[model samples]
Structure formats: structure tokens, C-alpha cells
Target chain A: MIRDKLCAGTALGRRIADSRDRLYRVALAWCGDEMLADDLVQETIETGILKSRQLKDENRLYSWLYRILKNAWYASLRKNKGHETLDEELLADEAGPFSNCQQLEIVVQVRQAIGRLPAEQRQVISLVDLDGLPYCEVAEALEIPIGTVMSRLHRARKGLLGKMTTAPSGAMTANRILHLVE
Target chain B: MENTEYSLDDQTLGSFVDGMLDAAHSETVIRAMDQDQDVRERVHQLHLVKDLMKVGFGHTKAPSAHSKKTRLATWRLFSPRIAASVAALFVVFAAGMLSQPYVNGQPGFPGEMLAAFSPVLSDSDNVILHISESDPQQFAAALLYAEKFLQEHRSQGYQVDVVAHAGGLDVMRADVSPLKLQMIEMLSRYDNVHFVGCANAIRVLREKGINPPIIAGVSTKDTAFDHIVGRLTSGSWKYIRVDSLVDNPGSA
Candidate 1:
């Protein structure tokens, strides 16, 4: 008899569900497309369910899920590399075309700036800066070294600062800092 | 007392913002920031960038609640009702075994085994397409629809499993299916595409002294619908009824 208990109402399922938004956010930042990000998150959950048994440590649940999502993202990247682009249209509108609010504009700029970063830098930055994962955990999730994470994080931050601050001479430093959002 | 080892570089500043620095390094960074305007400015920039990134990308909406329930039900397949129902069915089968009048030494074949061994491939990312029509034209249209759907979704890691039974079994038979070459080609190209035939129907054909020729890559199960239902009850698979699409097999 097949054991149906593995995928059933286990603690792992609940934990995976709880981290859905976090996965989506990282996916959105990584791919810069809403629909593609949604697909990545859903695929990650399905894969996680099928292979949850391979996860040996329960304490590493979130990082384990992140690793799954990251691998899925890379697989997708490889799959679509030859014939198509990954969300170029999503990066086209960096000025918040859908909204007129000034506050949302900065968020759009930040998104655009982050989008322009190299993919490696973008991945590390989203995991660290956006998701607030610790350096070691981010390294573990990405399967990279801690020093690499730090170096990438530094470059990603510098790149974002340059794009946001050097946009034009229209705004002062104080106003920019005031507009900084949490 | 300058800590020459860990300078106030961008890497150190970003780590400081992330709380990723060791206690000693963090203390040194804090003291450096207190004494140096440049360090404070860089630290502020890192904080602003981090916060801005959070505010910008952290707002992606979670998937719909209905989709969440569907995913959970399909992936987990362990609702109390489902488990209880399966248990009750097993108990009923066992009771029937006891009530049956003894014949030869061998226990009569368990009736539940028929449903249990439906030859459904348990691949996680499956899409079941049901076709009950034996018309060559209908089969062609159904295959076309499936091909279109598979082309769009196959890259996204979905398996398109076709279940044919009763009159539909003709669609999987090598002699009868008009699209045999096409089916073979599809099976060759996409491992995720599957065609399953019902054994009960085959046995019925044999009882009538007629032999069935199944196509390559066409698998057989005890009951096609039973297997489909089992998979539907257990996993999040897309089930498509393609007869309606025969006339107007529009884009998938």
C-alpha cells in the first residue's frame, strides 16, 4: 500500500504554505514578471511536496524550500535560454506606468535598478537584502560561499545606490532619505 | 585603536546592515561609523537600499485561496474524508471477503484490487485528457487539442496523460486509431505525453473473440476512468474533456 501520509497534513506542508509569499517575492524580484514568478512559486511547491522526504532537517525548511525554488528558477532559465528571453517586457516599464503616486514611483525605480543588476548579484541581493536571509543561510541556499555572498551583496548595493541617487539633480539627499521606505 | 583587519568597505557596510557581522566586527564597524562621516553615510545608503528593496519587491500577492486549496488537496491528497472513505472501502471489501461462500482453497479474488491497480502513472505533474469518442475525426481533433495544450505547458514541466476507454479505447489501438503515427511521434518527442487503455475493455474485446492491437507507448490499466479518478483525487492534475473541443478546437 502506498503511504499517503507523506504528503498529507504534515508539519512540512503547513510550513511550505506559510512561506509562499516569500517565495513569490523572491521569484518576482528574480524574474521581474508577475506571471512567471507565480508559475515558479507554484512549481516549487509542487516539487517540494513530491520530494519533501529528501529534506533531512526540518529546521532548514525555509532554506530548503529556497534552494528548491532557486534550482527550479535555474532549470527554467536553461530551458528557455535558446528560444526566448526572461521577462524583458517586465523591465521595460521602470517608471511605474500603472500608478501616479510619487511614493510608488520610488519603489518602481528601486525595482528597475535592481532589475538592471547582473543576475548573480540580483539573486544574492534579493535573498539577502529583500528576504533578509542571513549571509550564511543565503550562501547555503544558493550553494555558494559566504565570501561570495558578501561580495555580491556589496556590488548589488552599490549598483542600486548609484542608479537611485544618480537619477538626476532634481532631488536632494535629505528628500531621498525621507522617501526611503521600509 | 584602528581595527586594521576589517575595514569599513561596502562589503562590511552591507553585512553590517544585514546583521551578518560578528560581534567584534560589528563593534568595530559601529565605532568606526561613530567616528567617521563617510562610514555613516555609506551605512545609511545600505539601509535605505535594503528597505527600498523590501518595500518594492515584498508586495507580490499570494496566489488565490481557491488555488491554494486546490494545490493542497491535490498535492497532499490526505483530507480526513478522503482517508476515511478509503478506509471504509477497504473495510467493506474485507467484510465481503468473509461473507463470500467458500469455494476452492484459494480465496476469491479481492474486488478492490480491480480499482487499486488502475495503471495510472503517478508522475506528479500530470494532465489527464479524457476522450470517449471512437470517430477518427474526433480522435484527430482531440490529439490536435492535446498537442496544442502540451506545447504550451510542456516546457513548464507538465505531463499530458491521455485516458481512453469503452469506445475511446479505439483511440489507443494501433489498428483503429487514425493518428497512430502521430501518437507514436508525440510519445517519442515528449516523455510526459502518455496514452493509457482500459484492460476491462480489452478483455471484453477478447471475450468476443476479437484481438486488440495497442500502440507503442500506450499503457493499459484495469479501468481508465478509475485510474483517472484516483489520480484526480490524489494529485493536482489538469483534467480536460476534449470532445467539446473537436468541433472548435481553438487555441489551448
Candidate 2:
């Protein structure tokens, strides 16, 4: 009995570890705070493990995990008192593409552009474009219909394009690289 | 430049880029894109947007120190209880199996027990047979059975789609197979038959310098295996292994 429990636990642990990075990225993208993202990710993993038995189809694990992470992000957001004062330097450190920028000006602008995005657009763009999830899978993760996914993605792309084009040349170049991939 | 309004909307363009468009439709879109500068520019911009997004997201690093410790502590507390439950279930299952009587020197389990249980198993009032092989005899038998079945279900509105993929591409190839020609002619009269090929497979074939005639059907978005699995799980389709279908038509 002990051996069986250990085996189940190990299997669950491995799945959580395999999905940790993506879940953390999603959480970070949704919440925009490293500490809160971490907390959300941890809560998601814990909840997923406890409810793993409820998952009937193993093939849907990725979508199921994404759903859990989405729920946790929303729950954490509701519990928090307004937007937390995010440390700009620390956030810049966490931001990709700007991590190596020794020029503080470029990093600040890039971070600001990301921060300026409406929360809904930011989350949709992050999951679909940044994460590269297929439209169907993104719909499953967000608990929205495929049409909603398409509309949100379209809006997010429009918003991001507007921001990137208007930013300074240096930030635009960096953002062009970032936005193109998304 | 001749002004021709492209019918390919954003959804279709996205689907085309994602390789989700059916073959005939994709061919039409590709030809249009080649002829139109605006279409080409839009595609290029979309590609650029995708690349920029990848760079912006950054690499996924390992978990932080605090998270690692919390995970370890949680595991330590929960492991024992889970272990006990698993062991108890295993023991009960083993005991039940052992207590069963033997028949004909084999375990007296019913025939139904032998069939595997799929994770997303379901039942259907009608079955759709997806055929994607080049065997003429097998194809003929499948068609005969499907036709008879359709005749019975015609009033009830039962649907069946016979999708041909990969080597089965020859089954729907315009020029190669006379049997394919006859099958297509017969299927054209039926409202519920669908024949498809894998577009990715055709692309791979083209890259290898093989100009196998394009099948006269839509290409599946994913691999044949994924499509089959999805259909079977959803209970919309059932696999009739060509060999099994032909060899034991009465049984199937």
C-alpha cells in the first residue's frame, strides 16, 4: 500500500514539475508580479495534485493544468488589495529581451509598455501568442469559446502593435522582436 | 495588377498559416497569396509578430528557493496516507482475481472483459469508417459494407466519412487508380461520405521529389493517428482495420 502511494505521488510530482515552468509563465503573465505569480503557481500545482484523480483523460493534462493555473491567478487577484507596487528594477530583471540591456532607459520603456496593456489583453496575448498554444487549447485553458479566443487574440495583437510602434526606436526594435514571435 | 478581392479572411488566413485549411481551399489561398503583394505582406507581418512574441517571453527558469522547500514539505506530509490507500486497493484487486474460477485452463473471464477500455470511451448509434490505405480489395469490401449500412440508416440520417490518408492517398488520386475513380463516382452519389488526405504528408512527399497526384479531398489538420484517436474517443468514428474488415466481414 505504501509503495503504491509512493508511486502515485511520484507520478503526480513529475507531472507538476514538467508543467511548472509553463504554469509559472502563465501566472506571471496574468498577475504581472513575480511573488504573486509564484504563489499562484504553487497553489495551482497543489490543487492539481490533490484533484489529479478527478482527471479522467490523461491526454488532456496540459489543458487541465492550464485551467487550474488560470483559476489560481484569478483567485489570487481577487484576494490582493488593488495592484501591488511592483519594484521596477526587479520587474525589469524578470522581463525577457531587456535583461541584458545595460541602458536603464530601454528597460524601463519596455517594462512600461507591457504594464500599460489592459489585463485581459495581456493575459490572452501571453497565453496564445507568447506561449504558442493552439486556438482550441487556449480556449480550453481560458474556459472560453474558440470565437472568443480569436477575438481576444485579435484585440491583443492590435493593442500591442499600437504600443510597440509608438515607443522609442530602441524599445521598438526590442518590441518588434518580441511581438513578432508572439 | 488585377484587383481581385481575396475571400481569405483573418480566420482563414490564421488557419492557413497554422496549416488547418483543407487541401483544395489551401491551394486556392496559396495561389492567391502568391499573386497578391498585400496578402504576402500580411503573412510576413504575422510571422514577424510571432517571432517577437517568442523573444519577449524569455526562457522558463527553474523554480525559486521558497517554492522548492514548500513542495518538499507538502510531499513529506501527504506521502504516507496515499501509500496506504494504494496498497489496500492492490491487495483487494489481487485477491478478487485469484478467487475467480478457472475454465478451459484459462481464467473464466467473459469475452467483454478482454476489450481494452479507452480513456474517453463512448458509444454511437452509427459508425464512421475512416479508410486511408491503397489496398483495392479492402477498399471495395469497406465500400460495400458502408453502402449497405448507409442504405439502412438513410432514413435515420446516420453519417459516415471514409477519410483516406498517406499511402491511401492513391485511393483518391485523380489519375492512378481506376478503382479509386469508381469509388469516387459511387461516393459522389452519397451525401455522407468524406475522403481526406494528410497535407503534411503530401508536403513531405513533395520535398522528397514525389509528385503523387493530390487526393480529391480535404487534408486533415493533424496526423492520421491523432485524428483517429480523437474520433474514436469522441465516439464519432470506429476503426475498421482493413485486414480485419476484409477477412471477417461477417464478424465485423
For candidate 1, list the clashing residue pairs, or say none.
Answer: none
The worst-scoring run of ten residues by lDDT in candidate 1 chain B lies at B77-86
Candidate 1 on B183-243: residue-level lDDT in tens?
Answer: 7767877777788888888998999998999998899987765556455445455454445
- Give the alpha-carbon lDDT of every model: 0.63, 0.52
True contacts kept of each: 0.39, 0.13
Q: Which stretches of candidate 2 lie over 4 Å from their true place?
A: A1-12, A84-91, A95-112, A168-170, A173-182, B1-8, B66-252
Q: List model 2 lDDT by residue over A1-182, tens digit each.
A: 22234335577656765676787766655655555666677777777777878887876777778889878777765766454422221132243322121222333333345555666666667776667677787788888887777666666555555665686422345444443334
lDDT of each residue in B48-164, candidate 2, tens digit only: 545545444445343565544543211000000000001122232344432333435643322221121111111233444445566654454444445555655677655665555
For model 1, what is the error of residue A87's alpha carbon versus the real structure, in angstroms, after optimal superposition? 9.5
> What DockQ does each listed candidate score?
0.16, 0.06
Per-residue lDDT for A1-182 in model 1, tens only?
01243345777876676677889888878876544566788888877777888999887776788888889888987976763354231231122212212333454456666767777788888998888888888888899998888877877777777766765332223246446453
TM-score of every model versus the real structure: 0.51, 0.48
